[model samples]
Target: MFDLNNFNQESASLIQELQKHVGEITAIRRFFHQHPELSRQEFKTADKIAALLESWNIKVTRNIGGTGLVGVITKGLSSKMIGIRADMDALPIDEATHKDYASVNQGVMHACGHDGHMAMLLLAAKYLSLEATFDGSIVLIFQPDEEDDAGARRMIEDGLFDKFPVDCVFGMHNYPNAPIGQVMISHGPQMAGTIGLEITVTGLGCHAAHAYNGIDSILVAAHIVVGLQTIVARNLPAQDAGVITIASIHAGKANNVIPQSVEMIGTIRYFDPKTAAIMEEKVKSVAQGIAAAFGASADVRLKHGYIATVNHTEQADFCIKTAQKLLKPEAICLTKKPSMGAEDFAFMLAAKPGCYLFIGNGPGDGGCTLHNPAFDFNDANILVGGAFWTQLTLDYLA
Candidate 1:
């Protein structure tokens, strides 16, 4: 239980007003959880978000970057502007949480807590519209395809800023398993950049019994897999952060026959562009060299992904100070480490200065980790997160 007496009179009043709407905001979060949509396929999700914003008399724009939308709340005469974003897509996992409001749609769920994120932002919008007084404009971003594709990048390519440019942007995600009301942030690299890797190894096929009859692609792939591990160990400097994981591999279906080809796919994560390039070079070199030694051929393809989410120094400091004023002393996590997980919000940060922070979503004791089938966003955080966003917005635009 947070004590309102710790805050200034005006801040305390705003929190009290936001508390009155907790039930409504929680309902909205559950509604989104029940009807989750996949990346780039959020038609109904977009419609619902737009309707809610329009009903509040906020200016709404739709179909930016394929299903992404924007809502603008303007007050006073100052042109200074701020942008706040929330991702709208869900994952491909089937719901197993068995909550009363569990997903009605098959094979899709809001496993990443995007439902909670949207609800918090909407709560901020409602309060800002009806109660708060501030200058300049606030842009509420409803982004799509954050789970599988980079919807943030898509929205930027669609000219999100050119149309509704803001001086700075801010984003937040719900962190599962931490203390329910705690807030976490990093002053520098907050999330890692990613590169998608695909490798195909080609060799001759033969009967399994006659092991020497032809070149074995599976044997070559096995060697390559072991070799890729060395990129992080032998190639990269230990001080730098990097990961190379081969999550999937495919080969011959028949046990009695040797496969002619093997395909492997995985991801590379890193904080520095130079480190990423070094890892890429090592992967291609090792794979090709090993395949040739085994009398086979290897082809490597790399797809560029979201950049590392680096927070601007001044903006991050401002957020830290703001969190201190709003949260309990123990609820602020200044020592939290950056995550290897990637985020498309990096694209927006690249376009303008901003900060990305996280709000804790309680413990993960019962299959409650993110992207898990049984995971559900902690409903109680609706009020906690709502207050943080509302306060941050009021302070930034003050």
Candidate 2:
């Protein structure tokens, strides 16, 4: 059995030490937030991360899978290895938060709290380097393109695991709904997989004055959009969760013109892989049938996005135990249901047995939901998150 008293004492001391660096962490997060970089184009972000990691005398690798992945490895006495990941990409949304640290980059923002993740992991690196708290090795992964492109998969494809074999991997995201300093975790199906779909309905364009002179692609798109809803409502099982949303529709630019074709783009989300496949098929069938009814034809394309973030039960339980030992029992909340959102960390989980959890960023008073313009990574959670990472590393490597 692990000694709770010793663990608590050590964790509390670490938390106190982390608090001292809160200002520095906040500064780092703000700098990244101000100069936000988009998906795969995180060149500046990657350079900054590399420079920091190397400053700690931690061995660092750059341009691993692409231009934006920084892999820092610490060799220790024990051979056991674990990996910790932090995404380094920002969203494409324009800054709406009118703070001094508001995004300096035009039409880009760190609305998802990735900047905080990076800072916390960097703090972990600094602490680990100073104390050598863990017996085994730790791989610090700062990945890029998590907002849209699958940088995790790219790293895996480029032999991330093969190069530095890790027995287990762990990831964390800052959740907005949960209260600050509270940690939430779950055993399985933490987040859903996503698919982005685009459908183009083609029809004969004719003068708007004539009634039946040509097929109406706009009407066909509208029917397709409505028909797409029945797929989740009728086909999917009641217990299984699935969603289909038509987010974008474009056809005619002018008031009176009946455009030649209408393009519709949407997203599909599901937890189960089988259900996801079924939903994709249903989407195509519905689009084709709706277009046929309108005397039109549709070309449907579905692009597979991120996979479901499913946590390994054993790893999750271990993480919960670790959290309980480190923080007050009330600080950890076990989630009752899985979130419908998708995470690129799913790719890392696919490669190894691991878990993904949430470190609370507190309620959004003025801060909006994730991806919202007013959202900012709460500075209050910095110490909480950094302490959690440090403790988890020690516990896992113990």
Candidate 3:
């Protein structure tokens, strides 16, 4: 365990050691940033990562799920293991930051700091393999398609845990608009689950001048959209925090003709499974009911998305205490409330006892929010993130 009284002194030494390798860490991050790849298509990225792990003498397993890779470093047979995950996919956004290391694959950029995550985990693996200070093992998961195909679930379905079993697992993301190197974690639901909703209302088409001759799907869909909003505000309890967003509506191409059908697309965000269930049921009922009232029928399609990222209390405490010992007091933040965003790591946490936390990425540089074309992962975070992973592994395996 890290002693609060000696944390400052000990952390200083640990950070200094991590700083020595900053050059290599930043270089690796820049390489990934420049050669960004899309989900499940990270061929070159996986090659680079595998080559690096092999160079460090760590056991490497490839193709767990699409382009996913696993690096194992075992120190002794303690029967205790931990898994750390890093996403390895870029988004379909053009680079706008104009950084020297900006993505060269035009219209594809690592706009979500996944490049930074890869560098951090790789550096940690390098250090642990060299130091051999622990008695168990560390499993490094480099997953693909985090933004699209539910890569975490794919890896699990492909037998990730069966092959590389672990007592617990962990994951981290860079928090935008906060001081660089700062850490935030909490118990219970730290991020919401998402459900994508699409509803199509069908009706008879008619001439614009003779509107009463046919049923109006546009009107029915508009009613359904407005009715869906009531699920969170008027239907759900006041204490429950849920969000229903009608993000898109498509009706007719021509203003002169009444469209035969209208489509409504939106999302349902919730922390509690019961809340999500109720919202789904309500959306279907309201859409069908409204369409029936308007003399039309509705077809509802729901695409399930990431689930709520709930953290184990003990694991969350361990994360906080580890961060408090590894960094300055001001750098540790005990989050007050969960964010509305969703994460695929929620799937990994569902199978293991662990927590998914955030490391700060400093202030917004005009367009630093996640998934933005101008977003760039701060290089200053490398040392801090690498050191935190090292200390956590050491303490946990002690």
Candidate 4:
């Protein structure tokens, strides 16, 4: 076990104070969980965050882009600033955890642990506002619409970094599989870029009894799905990790007739832009080619969502070192493989040099995995996250 007594005095004291407030932090997390909101519509969440920040005398900004907000905490004239983001929106999955604080909103839940994320950042915000001993500034961002990948972009368009002028920014997410309290850090390609594709296969429709007279869109869609399965395997090289997932296909509704058109929708995940572009091109070409061979037409629409969350080397290393100062070295998982999932945090990293790291939710049982109907944010992990943020802020500002 790592000993906190070996750490610097400030670090130990901050961790001690943080651990003392576990119940309060967990209560705040449960409150957010009970009143969940969807992306770009976090009105109540934004208000609550603003109120909490205001209570601590952290300057609050409301409604920058949609329902997103920022809480600024400054101590001195130092130009250095740190940006810590916590997503406030919930997923569309229904709650299944059956906890006392399970989501009250129908068909919406904090399955991604945004509630814990908010609680951690809010804890840091409140603490720093009350007891910060740093010379620089910190911006606690309660971002919205992370599920939709529009929150970060919207916040940028609303002049977030421009308005605050931060030297670097950082973001945190909770991973369900890692042992709770473990921190995962990676420098490059921390997460994959995501592209959503919708391909509509069009063909002539006719009576099922006379199927030979008209083209079959359902058959064409099946071919497209099968053909798409090859782009990741055939087009991309072995070292280049990419995925082409065809999630949904909609076609005929009746048993007696062939459908006129079928829609195939899915996502493409990649780390490199060239590979993503190549995969997208192959998707359109193969889709159209197969559809045309079946006497059908394919209309493909590919919408680029979140970009790969690439981390800057210096910032990532700084984060790891900062985290190590507070916890045991083994508590930080530096070799954890980058996830193929995408994040809007990529946008902020694109504009600023920073790191986006993960806190472990731990796996195996109830409410651990993200976006699952049964997932709940682990309350115990809040101390780890809060301590890391608070110490990292004090260190960065120092």
* Number of residue pairs clashing in candidate 3, backbone atoms closer than 3 angstroms, sequence gap of 3 or more or interchain: 0
Residue-wise C-alpha lDDT for candidate 3, range 1-398, written one tens digit per residue: 12233236767766666767779979999999999999989999999999999999999999998899999999977988988999999999999998999999989999999999999888788888875478998999999999997899999999999999988889989988877777788789988999998988999899978899999888888888888888888788998889988899988888789999988888989999999989989889999999999899999998889999999998999988888777678778886478898888899999999989888898877899899988999887777778778888888888
| TM-score of model number 4 | 0.94
- C-alpha RMSD of each candidate structure in angstroms: 1.7, 3.4, 2.7, 2.2
Question: Over the full model, what C-alpha lDDT does candidate 2 score relative to the true structure?
Answer: 0.84
Candidate 1 lDDT over residue span 276-394, tens digit each: 99999999999999999999999999998989999998889888888877876677888778999999999999999999999888888788989999898887777777888877877
lDDT of 1: 0.90
Q: List per-prediction Cα lDDT, in the order shown.
A: 0.90, 0.84, 0.88, 0.87
RMSD of 4: 2.2
Off by over 4 Å in 3: 1-7
TM-score of 1: 0.96
What TM-score would you give candidate 3 relative to the actual structure? 0.96
Q: Write candidate 2's Cα lDDT for 1-398 as tens digits.
A: 11123235647677667766677777888899899899888999889888887878888878877865655555558888889999989998998999999999999999999999998888778778766556788889888888877899998988889987999999999888777767788888999999999999999888787638999888889888889999988998899899999999988887777889998888999999999989999998999988998789999999998999999998999889888888776677996478888888999999999989997777777756799999988776767777778888888778
Q: After superposition, how far is residue 277 of candidate 3 from its true place, in Å?
A: 1.0
- What TM-score does prediction 2 earn? 0.92
